[model samples]
Target: MMLPLLEMTYKELADAFTEQYKKGPALAKALYGEFFKNLNPKAWQAEEIQASPGLADRLREDLSFSPGKIVDEIHQDGLTKFVTELADGVRIESVILPLKTHQTVCISSQVGCRMGCRFCETGKLGLARNLTVEEIIGQVYTARRRYGRSIRNVVFMGMGEPFDNFENVIQAVRVMSDQRGLNIAQRHITLSTAGRIDGIEKLAALNIPNLNLTVSLNAPNDDLRGRLMPIHNTVSMVRLQQALRAYPLKKGNWLSIVYVLIPDVNNGPEHARQLADWLQPLRAKVNLIPFNPGKNAPFRAPHETEIDSFRRQLIARQIQVQKRAPRGRDLMAACGQLGSGIRQQGLN
Candidate 1:
């Protein structure tokens, strides 16, 4: 089997290079550094490093460095969504969202999701399979190359439930944070999950520095949350709250609570108060996301006035809150809105 060079750690790659070519650490560093410069299979050039004839060719062929194939690309508004096809032909979507100062890429951890959140389009696809570390890292590399700018942030909010693919996601993040590779700071990465208490406990135990955690907490109480997210049936809101309270966070850092505001579902003033009360114990910032309209979705986006009123009600209780503006909805690439699609479209 060919070794996946892009999925390797600095030490692993360096050791492999040293062992393969009988070279010292110097050659290992040179070749390892080159591989990441472009992240292409042929990134390491022999003439540039004074390697023996055919050594670079051998290295490139012996160690497979290919990421996934880019099946299609679509740009909507300021966002560009890339459809990546893995070796098995399973496709996953990653979105490049351009903000005022920097760009953020939303990557998928799984090919499909099983959480079955009523508001999420991805959930409707059912669970396909969890992506390997190489597959997850491929999305970041693809986005950085296509966007022609450094990605400032990464969110595991694209397709599947990240926590379900815990090990691979963490390994990918480690490779991404390595200074030799993508070199993304831990603070710039955030992992969002649908109230998986066990996953939250594991993350807290790992104490991964600066990696932010966001809970897809759409409803304030158990009954409503269970109605919205079926996972709540197993891990109730109270259990999730207890886990969040126990989860370790850096000083002054707060967990992000995502409240998807559906028109008549969970957008009442009382809901806001209950949300505020629920979050009062734990340090958290609320991101009120109006439901993005989707195919056959049972809910509609709340009115602007209702969104404003909800934010105000939370603020009145001394909770930090912000209304998340919808992006890439036209392309079905916004929050809770990634499904299998192939037609290409772009927006200027």
Candidate 2:
């Protein structure tokens, strides 16, 4: 006879163990091992678990542990989500964005970021830790099971720097994109980075087709960039631009040059000219992201008139530019703003 398989995730298993045995993961593991002591390892399979039937109350009463808010979000898609809190404390925030067209799962490479880009909320937390390969892939599995939606896009612009944790980051990417696994089309995937020079060179070697890139270029030059994004001080503008110019991927659309326009800092006409002069020869389209300050950020959005003038400069220079509108602000979930507790804390 085939052995009975355990249907719960690592998180659920750990949680259940704590409730029943009162403080012993080993005891729980041994008990669970006994429960599945039959013979067929190959038959054990993973599935998206949507419902818990009547086990919720019992489990809650026993363990006093509950699903995180992100778990609720996943279930909103009418699918099952299974999350695993890895041995490491690197919290993985993930969800399957279910839409009529396609499904996309956002994955975090690090628990937090060390880059400390002033405009980003995740950067404010300080660096916690880098996620392992299994943790990175867990985000995908959780999303796939919860909504039964086919995830088409994989964006690296989540909780941490994908390139900083290069080895695991690349390994996870390879595993997730493999034909035997998620098999998501390269065209639908994008990797966003805050200008990591060596990482750029490493990515260039892959030369994966249809894999798009987005560089966070908030300032036009070294002086301004160094002020807003400390990474600029470490990775000089000359080196970053050289990386962009020599990026291995063949052409399609210009790589997205994300420029976050703070109210008075990078919004003036002179700033635009400087930006245009720098970008006129680069192979990229500019994406103007109006600065939306977080709880502790010292920034504000630019005025419409000032933004219009900025766009005109790029257009006049024959450089493609698009001022991207802010979305999910009601949830503190816009560009340059993620995991900021804007939603749950009701900070608005």
Candidate 3:
């Protein structure tokens, strides 16, 4: 149990205030005061650093992503670890994916999820609530203390429907990209949505480079997309493709098309061809993921032969295709696997 006297980090302070005490603006201010008090006074005294405007902006703004957080165990194992909890019966999981090069924190944007997809564990719980900006960003600070370094990348693909929690999600993204704190480049960040039509437009307006905006495109046709993801029932593939084309994207920036290959479901070479045909016009890349099985998730991954066949088919058509290495599986860290501990402990 945390003592009332513990020197809480910015995130800890916010969680205590919003989730526990129910105060909003006042708690946000107090958290800011605490942050100002802890900032290192001797950070920017170097002569070369003072000469560059870009460097100054980085120091003052983009670096302030996760305030008042630290890694407790992220650095020791050189791998990610998560802490699961529930406030008012809503499941929340925080992840820190670590590597030799840099650490990345995967944070959730909502409790459970309203965008119920067939393959996601979080969505199965249904939507409880959209997390506040502070609640979303707090996970970063908590991971930092456990791990020991500022994370190099942030992927908003953890446990919730990031776009469904649009306003708060963007606010958290803004704070994370702020220069006054964590100076992470927006390019190094990624956001995945099941498929939210309006959210894609908003992201396009942000115009942040190398922001890997990904869509979970699991099917070749509307019928299949609707079957895999319930959101497609409303925002069909045809409409999603239209929204994606409207986005002002960089030349080389491809809208990452995430295809979860499940046995006999969406794992055939013909399905691959159909998908490629559907996406040939869009500036996009296909990331073939062998479905990560979760609790009560009926889907199973395709055979390696089937996966290779699909990848080759996409590549033959000159579509940029790559297979993403699944991470944190040992610790149940893949997408939709983060909340098992909470369930086991009866927290949610």
Global Cα lDDT for candidate 1: 0.83
Per-residue CA lDDT of model 1 for 1-348, tens digit only, reads 456866877887768767776766666666666666565556557355555667666766777755788887898888888888888777888999887788999999987799989998888778888989988988888777778547868999998888999999999888888887778888999999998899999999999959999999999999999999999999776788899999899997889999898978898887887888899889899988989988666888788898898888889999999888887778888899876463222110
Q: Write the per-residue lDDT of candidate 3 for residues 124-220, one digit (tens) a residue.
A: 6677677767567666645554555557688887778788888777766666665435545778778998888888988888776667898888898
What RMSD does each model have against the real structure?
3.0, 9.9, 9.1
- Top TM-score prediction, candidate number: 1
Which ranking of candidates, highest TM-score first?
1, 3, 2
The TM-score measured for candidate 2 stands at 0.73
What is the C-alpha RMSD, rounded to one decimal, of candidate 2? Answer: 9.9
Q: List candidate 2 stretches off by more than 4 Å.
A: 1-90, 95-100, 342-348
Candidate-wise lDDT, in order = 0.83, 0.64, 0.67
* Model 3 bad stretches (over 4 Å): 1-78, 84-89
Clashes (backbone N, CA, C under 3 Å), per candidate, total 0, 7, 26
TM-score of each: 0.94, 0.73, 0.76
Best by lDDT: 1
Write one digit per residue (lDDT tens) for candidate 2, span 1-348. 111112333344547556653545654344333222211122112111113233333333433211222322424223222333445423445544555787766667777688888888878766778776656765664555454436678778777888899888777666556543355567777788999988888888887757788898888788989988898898787788888888865656568888988878888777888888777668788988888777667877677777788888779878889987654444455566665752233211
